[model samples]
Target: MEFTDHPTGKRLAALSLAALGVVFGDIGTSPLYALRECFHGEYGIAVTPENVLGVLSLIFWSLMLIVSFKYLTMVLRADHDGEGGVLALTTLVKPRKENMTRGAWFLVILGLFAACLLYGDGMITPAISVLSAVEGLGHITPLFKPYILHITLAILISLFLLQRHGTAKVGTLFGPVILIWMASLALIGLHQVVRTPSVLAAVLPWHGLHFLIANKLHGFVVLGAVFLVATGAEAIYADLGHFGRRPIRLTWFLVALPALLLNYFGQGAHLLSTPQDAFHPFYAIVPRWAIIPMVILATMATIVASQAVITGAFSLTSQAVQLGYLPRLRVTHTSASHKGQIYVAPVNWLLMVCTVGLVLGFRTSSRLAAAYGVAVTASMLVTATLFYIVMRKRWEWKLPVAAGLTALFFTVDFSFFAANMTKITHGAWFPLVIALLVLVVMLTWERGGEILAERARGLTKPLDEFLKGIADDPPKRVPGQAVFLTRSHNTVPVAMIQNLRHNKVLHSEVYFLNIRTEQIPRVPNFEKIELERFGSGIHRIIAHFGYMEEPTVALIFTLCRDKGVNVDMNTASFFLGREKLTIGTPPAMARWRSSLYLFLSRNGMDPAAFFDIPSEQVIEVGARLQI
Candidate 1:
């Protein structure tokens, strides 16, 4: 039943192969444009040996320190039950002392913003990655130039359309092909390196510093393009649960890191000898007869890369919804064995539209490159800030130790961020604007939900005490069981209270069901149900779920029987309370914000359907309130 059953070495090797297809796919394809961009992009500096060696040195060190150390060595170790991401990191942070400081709130907001920016990354990465890959066709024939846009569109559109079908199959098959891709990158770059031995000298740190000194501001600008090499580094940690630290670290250190540095230096060496090759150095390095074949391979690699990001976006959105930051969304499980493979309709279609729009608007990879690095550097910096908090507060590291590591991360992160900042007017504003809008929506919903909870709390009555009153009165008891869904355990459900008040009768047995999503990804099956009994046939049932899990009423019923609470689904009635919000009195939020919250509430998904309650067995009680 396990995914991997081989010996540790073989199993790790298989997982590492799969990791290349998913974790490193995005960064893997960077070779197609990263080095080329340094010398050919709009901000590209002169192709002198110093600049070439400097850029190569920067690219190499960036991968080791940023991707290897900061992420694999540091951030990957901070997983929340083996989950990693900006939102996941937020859960790890504890208050530095007590009363939430403005600083604590700032870290929280920064984490949210960092998470939001990734949607933009999701859209832009596919466009730029695919565009850059297909653009390689230009190297073969000028005839392909006019048709490049059309070709890119066709590939991207096809890729997005396939999301509904899921990528489990493609992911399975992509492992070897990606190995071929990496091997091809190394082989081709090695061919160039052998011809030009002088390029290896750039491996030293002095060349990078000397180049930066000679070029000054221009060198800083080139750092923005160099950043493309490590943009997919975040995937290393994001996918820690899938492959584990050993496989991912092994892949990075053994396969990916070496191939990337050699290829980059090879490109630098080639460019030093043949400066005219800057146009499309990645494809240019290939033999003339192999150019078309290499382009084909590169395009396929880009598709797999795009698949990883698209899949990541879906997973993140699901987590956000489960954690209560967003409204209920329709989530479809694509694989019976793999709960992680999910498809979201709204998110899928929205990303498609935005991704296609980016392709059409940006027109070329060179132009899209300007918009790419901004969000990446910003999110990385935010992660550093959060990671520092975890070290100091959670891990109990000394402030100086935490500060030293944070400073190292920040230096690299900020240098890239400052370099990319110059891109805002050109195109970097895109992700920032998207992140800001999403931040507003998230914050508004959070505050609005808090206000609603406050009002609901005021109306809550102690369940045991309320049941005692009913016991004294002895309201007429009916047959069959009533399951009332409540938001909290300590309070009586509004539906149960209303049913008693208006209907003047209670079911023979009443069950108060409260569902709570836990911070971890999944609750153990044995620990899913917790029950407490009270007088007058009143029972409280608490169901627990992980963020990655779906909680269904049917599952609850099935599991409850094993825990000594038996019920027949055919005869049971499910009760729900719908609150209609009206903006009046001391409004819970600003006028516009209140309206936004109301709009969201009215359109919010039906809890019955979301919980998989039988439609025929459901009864609703409605009440109006001013928030």
Candidate 2:
């Protein structure tokens, strides 16, 4: 792995600040209404001092355990290529099995399903965050109540409109605004805390435990509310590669976490001092003069939060393509300098449409919140399971220690998942719909690839026989040396053999390059391109790479030479078979689904970008196939 120093002298601060804006924005904004909705929602709570403080205590400690301990502190370090998230973490942790076991495959499918769920959460975060912030207007002035829908729609439209531009461009303003938002939360809540000093007792963390133990009947319900605070915690892991662990950890511990806890405590204190304000304590703590500005600032914070999630979805899709779970989608480099910063038009539009629907359908932030946490919780739970396997198999830790850690998380997660299940009837399907769609696409891609590979293997000739025939009748016209990238095992690619036979063109040395995905994500960099002599100046080059890493043709060719494979990059041309699929009867995919894959393939990432191949030297040979 290549590690570079901070981009500038101020890089530590700048990256930390940017991470605060991008990574924590979604989770950070949870305080806007996490508690209010907790008290007011189906949990059936009153504006009493104990209930508010108890719930506030739960919120604070939940963040400490789930976000701080379980994820930020521990899981962020389990990054794959500086990337963290369920999928990235999965790429890091997949264990070797002698054969595919039902349990192992079950876990794989579950984790993928969890990833699909995040797309749902991605759409919901913006909808709920924006709506909740806009809803704050009702507290400031009653006249704003009737126009809430219009105001929300307008704000949402503006938010979606701003997305064409990358977050890095407008990110300079995010930190200051989030800083102010957190400061105001602390200030407002602190004022109320001073008014009712006893409210500080809620910080003991035991009150949260007692709430669960004493109120066994409704503990699960309260957990549903508590989970909201940690809704976007997975983003921290998913976006880990965007900003390293040090800066993100520092930002959270030194800045974001403190602000959130203080404000949550402050809000609790205010509720105890004036029960009436519990109806809208976040705003009630503020002065009339400050309420409007607070609303505006909150709106900005929510928009930023939503933007981070949107960007995360884009990154996840890119990873999916490289890993072969999904067919390639057109990936436009959003920043020429950063390979990580990319834009997928289909994803952007899909998220935009779903978000707009959420804003319109829910119409209120509180309603959207019900559907939000399920996906995030499921995603975190999946990460925990994957990490547990890593600790045991890769890290070779004692099984008890890993199981204990995983159990703690699973207990909390399962409880929350069950709680959220109560909400399945109330518009949770929006996310489930997106998850199902992505699952189908991913599974179809895998199945289709398998069927196609089996078909190719059956149809292709043996390597020894084909090469023997080639030696007997050598072609006259030729390039100095040529390498053909192929999927056919052992034998030469059908196209290359066919081209040599018909065009009568042959190189002094013909290299067959076959790239394969291994079970693990990291192979020694030195072992990149393996070579074998097939005689007659013909060598087979099998390049090995972990999906987490990029495939650079020049670098691979260089590694081949270093490994004693006779190949020259400047004189060699790369031949990539472009398999054009025409839909036909295949048990792997239905007609409509096959159509979708074909359409997605046509619109997918350009081969040049996907393979990191230079366009001038890269040649695409069209191969027609029915899958």
Candidate 3:
């Protein structure tokens, strides 16, 4: 909606090209091997022209229905401010209650789990795409077979080496390369289609249905294949903030849609004409003279897809920090022009290492496909569930329609997940392992906070009463106006209450601020903030902000004036506690995980910037505690 920070212009054509480069990288490249897998599932090969065509048709319609109708057209409009990730969406849908209910919180947790699954997908995408491209070496010459690993390693290493520099610098090449890749797909597929016009049958959705209804075993594998085509569809919605809804919709309808269909149909035709050439259908479609160039182009496209996912992971992590699922880390804004463009060093290197490990371990796209769908599928299901809640609760859509749509999506997604479960022994474990580890860390941080909060309540004093007591004394030594930002709604922080009781120091006109996030797109005026007066100049200000809204200290402090709470911006000293969580008894996690949380928390983004509080005016008091 904002077209992000950097305005790229009103020329729809240029934006479409950029969208193709950024948004469609994952789904566009699925043509390379998506079809080959449809025929070669876990059981055997019984793919016919009708079935393949049916599968391709299913892929097209699935993208149209799930991605276009469900997400891009509908869900993208439901942005929490201009942000469009799963977390933002979840925040938009979280239900309000009198008490902090676990049921409402579970939705947030599921959305977080979906984000974790995406990290797994992020690791595997580059590996599988690059490996699949490089594996074309085997098709070229048997001698190339021996050198596949070296070539793949070189390609992957080069890709990782290029990460420090932003994609904007090299992005001109992505569009043209992907365009060429699409052309190659069409050219190869067209050759086979001319030989057997019957291959055109795959364009019909009913054919895919017949294949599914008629053949049970092959249909399950086809779900895995269909899953690939829609893998990056979620990016269209996630990146809606980047390119805007119109640009992405236009690109998907005009350029991306045609290119993908032509290439898929071409591949289907090629396979039908030369059924025995099924060993490597995509590469076989190209002439000998064009094969090397195809491989190079494929390599380039896969790298682009990988880079897009890599950057996406960085953005998601940054958002997670803002929303409090992650600990603060060092986030360096990479782009001078784009506030959304960020570079997280740890995320970058970790991704590069994990991707390289995945590429080497899987060794081929066919093998990597096993791991691909599970994470994406799980993510899709989670998003669908969240969206249903948004429709019913937020948008006030009819219960039946919302529930039916959600159930259909969940059924499809879970079935694919069940099918991929069989792939666990294969390289699929890589993503599952990554997802579980991330899930544990996320839940651990949250649960640990609850444990600490409970402990703090017992030990801490009533902050309002404490401040009132200090005000009654009228200490001449007390400083100017003060604003203390806190995470808890009740009484003094354990850190501060302990500090004052043992090491007594008090300030006049003390403002206790509690910044709490609500579970809706926007907070109503009634829910904007709550101020309850305490005796003396001391006051408790509980500000309820939607997760979508940027929490600016300047704005909130100004609003405090309207509510009859006074604070001098220049003289008001803001105090915030920086909790350094430690391992102790009544453990929320295992020792190793606690160690990981400590490590992650230490590296998290500084709290000063997170709250938009100026560093010079803010005093951070460190508190060591066990969660």
Candidate 4:
């Protein structure tokens, strides 16, 4: 069930609090390095009073326009059955691919690429966040400088290793800890802001515009670092299903946005007074005594941010697999109460490896910051593009209205993206390369699945024709029920044909089961199964599930029982087709793609295990196919 389904007072408050921990984690932790990067990072500018106000203005308006207006107010409404994300948005716009326009298809591909980009963001967020937080120790004492990298790596590794245990136990602490973190940000930032009230004038858009006009090309480059403040904005929409729109919006407006603004302005205030502290303004505002405690709290907050990103990656993988863009992987549901909490072993480990590599390679958060915003900015651009389609197609907005709003969003997103592009030589290429690789995999997996399905259709006979043949030349009748898994209910399963050919017998009750994934987030139990009886105890049952859900044999049987189709699991023998794919004479795919596809197919989770089917009752019928 969606978190927003029952929006009572207590539930809404709880969800909003939870939203603070998860949805705002990435963006919430930006104070550690965002403003510092603007003045002291790879493309950092001079710390003049005007420049400081300009940068602060840019950061301020970005949060207001991009995060607050575009994402929270606009994109959040584009959810697909209460689910949000690039994949969810893609499905919402194009529920069915039949007769889709070229523009529509491009949006879908763009959305996939966008989702792939998040994987890159997922890797960088943890590394940079933890590194930036740990770097605070160096400010405390020169003694810790040598151990900063080691400490960051240790913390990151420990955090990832704990993924299998699930977040339920520790998740409770996230809300309270983040609440404290946000409170600390506001209090410290306010302390600085009160000392230098002039920093508040950065709220004016003219300071930002004047800085851009005065600095020219250099000012444009500064935008790349300035964009860091808006990095985790996408997570707000992504976690929509988990917390609901109201709670997420409420949290951002009432809690996250205010704290973030106060802290950023405070950093600017500190910078205006003591420009030398530009190296670490976030820590500069803290009292000497509180520096160590703040460091500890910052480390914990960054860890929470990293956890959110890791969880997002797992969720994205599940959605991509169900939506047919990715190969099926083993998904372990972490929280019994929260369906959104899941663990994918492969994703978790791959992320840990990449994240650790980033920390080791970059050596510091300032260097890692150069690579951070590229994927996120690109992803936001994709979201704006997709949101335009959503506004037009789903929301039915007028052409002018849709185009105007999209253009505004596009301008902001593209500016950030273009600025980030300049960092390609520094370190941004890493995430871009990662994104490209993932996009290729997604495209290959999707194309390969289509080819395999086409080949399977050619090999299997039509269901009506096969049933008529069975009626005319009746096979030897056997006791119990036989459940044959098929991709389409309109065709006979190759496994069923192979079984009858070898054993020359049919079970008394035959169930031709087809499990289909829908574009929506979920299908209600009542509408999940469609049962049609052909004749002679032969039935065709189509189990419909949403991309967010897992399809299992046990659940199917239970649903069948509810539909008056008594399915005795103990007596039922499940038949499955195990295809051994080989390269065709005229290669349907490029050689490398074919090889990758083959490897993925070979390594993919077994169907029986994936569907939670009983292994002893599953009878695999082997078939050779070329594609």
Q: lDDT at 588 for candidate 1? A: 71
- Tens digit of lDDT per residue, candidate 2, span 1-627? 322244445888888887888888898898887877777766646667667767878887788889899988778778775557787666555545465677777777877888888789878888888888888889877999998888877877776666666655676677777777777777777776777788778878788777777677576676787788888888887777677888888889988898888778777777776777655667877778988999999998998888788877887786677678887666666665655566777888888888888888887777887776667777777888888988887788898898998999898788788877777777776788789889988987777777667666664677888888877876674557777887755766866855765677777777888776554444577877778887777888888876545566777787876777756666668777778778775534788777776776776676566667767777777666777
The true-versus-predicted C-alpha distance at residue 435 of model 1, in Å, is: 1.4
Question: Per-residue CA lDDT of candidate 1, range 279-363, in tens?
Answer: 7788878899999999899999999888889888899888878877777877888877676778988888988999899989989
TM-scores of all predicted structures: 0.96, 0.89, 0.84, 0.99
- C-alpha positional error of residue 148 in candidate 3 after TM-score superposition, expressed in Å: 2.7
The digit string of per-residue lDDT tens for model 3 on 1-627 reads 356444445666677777788888898888777777877644334656666677777776777777767777777777766667787777776665455478778887788888887788888888878888888878888999978878887877777666666665677677677777766776676666677677666656787688778778767766776677778977777887777777788778777777777777777777666667666678877888988888888888988888788888888876665556667656666566655556777777888888888777767778778677877877888888888888887889898988888887777678777766667776667776897887887777666556667765666677666666666765444767767776677687654564465557667567778887665434654567788777666678888875434566777777777777767777787787777677878566777767776777676666677667778898777677775
Instruction: Sort by lDDT, best first.
Output: 4, 1, 2, 3
Q: Which candidate is the best by TM-score?
A: 4
Model 2 segments more than 4 A misplaced: 1-11, 96-99, 209-219, 462-464, 479-483, 507-511, 515-575, 578-599, 602-609, 612-624
lDDT of 1 at 502: 93
Q: Which wins on TM-score, candidate 1 or candidate 2? A: 1
lDDT at position 247, candidate 3: 79
Q: What is the lDDT of residue 242 in candidate 4?
A: 88
Better of 1 and 4 by TM-score: 4
Show how many residue pairs clash in every candidate, following the order shown: 1, 3, 9, 0
The better candidate by lDDT, 1 or 3, is 1
lDDT score of residue 417 within candidate 2: 83
